[model samples]
Target: MGFMSGEELVVTLAPVAVYWVYAGIYEALLQHTTVLDRYRLHSRRDEETKNIASRKDVVRGVLLQQAIQVAISVAVLKLEGRGAAAAAGDGRAAQPEPFLVAAARFGVAMLVLDAWQYFMHRLMHSVPCMYRRFHSWHHRVAAPYAYAAQYGHPVDGVLTETLSGAAAYVASGMTPRAAAAFFAFATVKGVDDHCGVAAPWNPIQAAFRNNAAYHDVHHQRGGGRRNFSQPFFVVWDRLLGTHAPYALRQRDGGGLEVRAFKPDPTR
Candidate 1:
């Protein structure tokens, strides 16, 4: 058997491919044109002046993390004998899953991923050393953009993203193909959350409550201390009292911006 082939390759690389294509589209729209200006959560001035990490640095960090993800995926496939079994023509033909079953698995995966990310992400912030060493790199982008979604310390990425994904897949009992799809969907969601655009017409944005505006709050100065749930539901945040409520208001110039508000004490 070659090092990796068939479903193994797809499972390993599909999410990475999806991440770049989705994020690249946002990069092109945000950087090359003024068309999306009205949808932007922050002004171009904020993106340029407030962000500490350069584009080059963000790209390099994402690439490194992706490489690590791929390596870990390959290792998992080898250990599970999945690649070898497929290559050897094991008699078990791939069976089509029932639609309802597939849906259930997807739902379970989302819940598992959200719970894992919520707790792990919260822990990263709760502990000062972990935040400084692992998570702070991601916070460098005060005015986030699409491609900066995965820009973080590799160790942080492995702990929060890579392992959480694996846990979701294992817990949901999803097939490799389903896991691939889930990961790709997650990549798109993560990129959208950081796109810094709250385009009302975006279906993905409309479908999920934890959209760009919600995540943009976490990237702000004081806002990082709350809203730790990510890329999916806000159940954990709400339950844990970490949900920083925010309102999206029209910017003075054109677009929209997120302003977090304190909840009423009596109400």
Candidate 2:
């Protein structure tokens, strides 16, 4: 809330930084190993799915938006009356908060973000011009990879990512420390949603409904509609009658093939 000391800034930035590294490792492991290949929703990867330029685009967008979030968070925390400026090495205040404090507030923040993002995503799909001008950049990857989550147009990125997280953090009744936790968890979940694997053993998929397979349907829907929510829970799409049911059927040789059937809106 107050001016971020160097140490506080480090704490705030750690989530974004750590998530990137973890996602990179996971992405490579999934690609190089057969242990989880059975979970590849679409056996065929797109030309741009793992392109270096695409990864750079995603990284650029993520870092720029994260910088904006850091600046905005200072103000948000201040408004919450928790942003107290600390003097360097003054020992007058704690250096930074412990992790549990951040974790305790993460769930509320996640729910707020997911709800806001669900509506925003549907709105983008509904507007033809909005989809063409911005959201379509993300949909280019019919079979998306982990880093592809952030590879979106700048305008869309600001609206969906930055705005979603900021609003959620504020609405969570969270302190600055908790905001950091929210960012970290969000970054990780976002990548996992687009990671292109849906192993039954994956705890993320098991814990929440929005697994990699869940989001893969969103990317590969091949239509401009349905399965719009990201990260966790297919709540909005289910409520809106737009959540399609999908299954992986065994092919003649043995691999799995994704098949999505539109849910009858009238049902």
Candidate 3:
């Protein structure tokens, strides 16, 4: 328990709270943008404004999934003999300052976690049984909103958080405070990916679209066997020869409909 007092705990959590609040606002705006006439996404919940009112639905699902994840994380930390209960009354224990050491750890952990996530994400899709059982729910929401990001089955949610959390834990130099920041940042990023504005200039979104369009295109086409990279770079896909040749193909007048990669059963 690095939380020395109620005030200290508030200070530790304040940034994460603010980040999520901003995500909530950004998610609302982005979801609206996604369903706008420009994107040709049909509105499902509005008639007067020709807009969808999916914000509440998406928020409810995300919150529910996150609540369950938090509960499971608490249980896991308790079982591992860590957390406030373990650290309580242990003045000898060294706790990193939340603002400094923890913040740095968060940054490093995110970078490493992003790379780890990229590869593991591809495995989830490559394994057919696992994809059907554990990953299909995520793909079900083809026309996704921000809240739709977390609208997955329980096992899927657990596996997703566990992988990211384990990556954060393994990433060197992480303090508990930094771990909190990583969790907060990861949550926001997940929600934002579903916010669908195609803002190519936005750094994070740009990286995601260029490197990880497999999952996004999967939503559009029900399946795609290309562009399976994630997070920061498409190096893995490029090396594997599975990278979607979107840019080259587009220049040659081909479209982004990923079904082109499908193998012909009749062949």
Q: For model 1, how does the per-residue alpha-carbon lDDT over 98-185 read when each residue is reduced to its tens digit? A: 8999899999999999999999999999999999999999999999999999999998999999999878877887767777898999
In model 3, what are the clashing residue pairs, if there are any? none
Q: Whose lDDT is higher: candidate 1's or candidate 3's?
A: 1
Best-to-worst ranking by lDDT: 1, 2, 3
* TM-score preference between candidates 1 and 2, better one: 1
- Higher lDDT: candidate 2 or 3? 2
lDDT of 2 by residue, 1-267 (tens): 345655457546776686678677877777687766666655544434533345666678667766775665566655544435343343424455456755556767777888989888888888999998988888766677777677777778778877787788777656555566567777788888877777778787789877776676777656458788876778888888888888867654434556788866963
RMSD of 3: 6.8
**Clash count, one per candidate:** 0, 4, 0
**Candidate 1 whole-model C-alpha lDDT, 0 to 1:** 0.88
Candidate 3 residue 258 C-alpha distance from true site, Å: 10
Tens-digit lDDT string for candidate 3 (162-181) = 55566555554454444555
Candidate 2 regions exceeding 4 Å error are 1-3, 6-11, 44-56, 59-61, 65-71, 78-81, 85-105, 251-255
How much lDDT does each candidate structure score? Answer: 0.88, 0.70, 0.52
Question: Which residue pairs come into collision in candidate 2?
Answer: 1-77, 1-78, 1-83, 2-83
